[model samples]
Target: MCNIVGIYHTLPCCSSLTVSLRCSLLLSLLKVANYSSLDACLNLRWPSAESEILPRHVPKGYFVMQVLRRCPSNTSPLTLQHLKSVWKDVAGDLNVDESLLTDEDFLCCCGSSSPSVNAILGGVVSQEIVRAITGKGAPHGNWYYFNGLQCTTTVEWLPNSAISS
Candidate 1:
């Protein structure tokens, strides 16, 4: 099957989040450091989107520091409590040494990137933020790898602690 992303649930309230979007609908929201209001934010664009020669392999990490029983976090300065319980057993050598994984490695493996990569980033971030605010879906796991050129993304999730050890 073709690689598909975006909202695809068909139910009233669409989980109380606007209307139901079709199979693949990319939603994006832009935010900048400064003023307030979503619409009144600043505008930014890459001067040169074609500088890169190929698809870049970007290895990233994420974790749920804390799962709140409520919606928003009241504290301003939050902290990260590692999810070792979820990743330790099978995390393998994934991000064991992040130092060695560099842009050069990706260009050597994947293909070149386009200006649209930024658009992809915006959409993914927006999706996660929406899920967090509305509690409609779960965010990414502790690990993920993306090929910017091909626009291929993969997420790595650990076994639920309750079901594991």
Candidate 2:
């Protein structure tokens, strides 16, 4: 259960230059302006290969996390309009333009609650995203690490609001 802080502590300052560089670049891309946000963002479950400290595909998991956090509720299915609005909020929070994020970008469905083709986030299927976000196959927060270990990561639902930094 190695968190970002834990992993950072495991390595000498000079020994983790690559991790440092990746962190800086990812932090900028994700528009994390503070230390706390960086911690939360890095702690989220991401796709990774063996023993990788960071997620293999960060942006995909990150976008899914943001969407889930912004959702009004977890039980009720999310609507496209609501999803669009949530994306707008996400853009605002990241200080990016609304145009940069659209329902089409994520392939979210419009005017249909029934799940099907084109109903989920574009390339990333809704079920797969949910599974990863809930830590089924991916690493859970503090429950497992990206160090290629066999640990039981818990499957927890997303909170109603975004993770406070």
Candidate 3:
């Protein structure tokens, strides 16, 4: 398995350029972690996990998704199509099977390419209103599916007594 902490240390903060870089980085990590026999397309030197800053109570997969989903004010939101295009390019560059990068492997709930008109506003307020009205609506934050599994954005902290039980 690939060391996510090591990969995290090597990544730069989110910006337009950095977002693209991070995309490449994430794909590389996925390639390494998922495929053993395939040679990497990019000759990236992964860093050691010596100076890692861990996120609060998040798994490596969640942390990586957070990093991938970050869209700074200066950058446009990343679309699944763009990600797939990048994957294809990377596969071509690396001489690997493009089929390996499947939609089921990575799912991102980003805005659609075509614009649409909706009655309800979208944000925290919208989500709260929907929840209060219908008891169920959209999820709290951006949705991501990694390794064919979905993850919750929020984490609950159990009391120390509960943990001890």
Candidate 4:
């Protein structure tokens, strides 16, 4: 059986560049977590355990998403503190106004892509996801690039040296 993997595509759209990077990260995060996913493409509201970080009520165009995963060997914890730090670090690097990125506000761009873009890119990501889970190809390495304008895609292996300590 193909090992399962999970993905979270909140579709952060600070800009095209960062959006592409974030999309790649969504795919990579799925592979890293090693859990099956539905691409977080829900069209309905749902409950969230991190409700405090979200708004009191989900706006009409908004919904809740919560994901929980386990480390393959039960080797470490995925605590709230760890996620908070990671989010802060990523926000700083992305030059995002952290305050504007709350769960309710952040999802503003979730379905903003053109239908054409979604069809093409969605298939590409889905195919890669299957390949990664079934051992047809290596799990999403560390980075990828998708240039919708150029109709091209590229994958990059991120070096540990590039990640800050």
Q: Would you list the rank order by lDDT, best first?
A: 2, 4, 3, 1
Pick out the ten consecutive residues of candidate 2 with the lowest summed lDDT: 143-152
Predictions in order: lDDT: 0.35, 0.42, 0.38, 0.40
lDDT of 4 by residue, 55-149 (tens): 32222122111221212225545554443444465445433334533443333233345677778768878888787666444455343445444
Off by over 4 Å in 1: 1-113, 157-165
Q: Which ten contiguous residues of candidate 4 have the minimum total lDDT?
A: 62-71
TM-score of 2: 0.31
- In order of appearance, the predictions have TM-scores of 0.31, 0.31, 0.26, 0.28
Model 1: per-residue lDDT, tens digit, 117-154?
66777787788788767646445643344556456787
Question: Candidate 2 on 97-139: residue-level lDDT in tens?
Answer: 5565445435533333334333323434455567655533432
**CA error at residue 106 for candidate 1, angstroms:** 4.1
Error of 3 at 17 (Å): 63
| Model 2 accuracy (lDDT, Cα) | 0.42
> 24-101, model 3: which lDDT tens digit per residue?
767664421122121221121122132122223223333233334443435655666665666665556434456654
Best by lDDT: 2
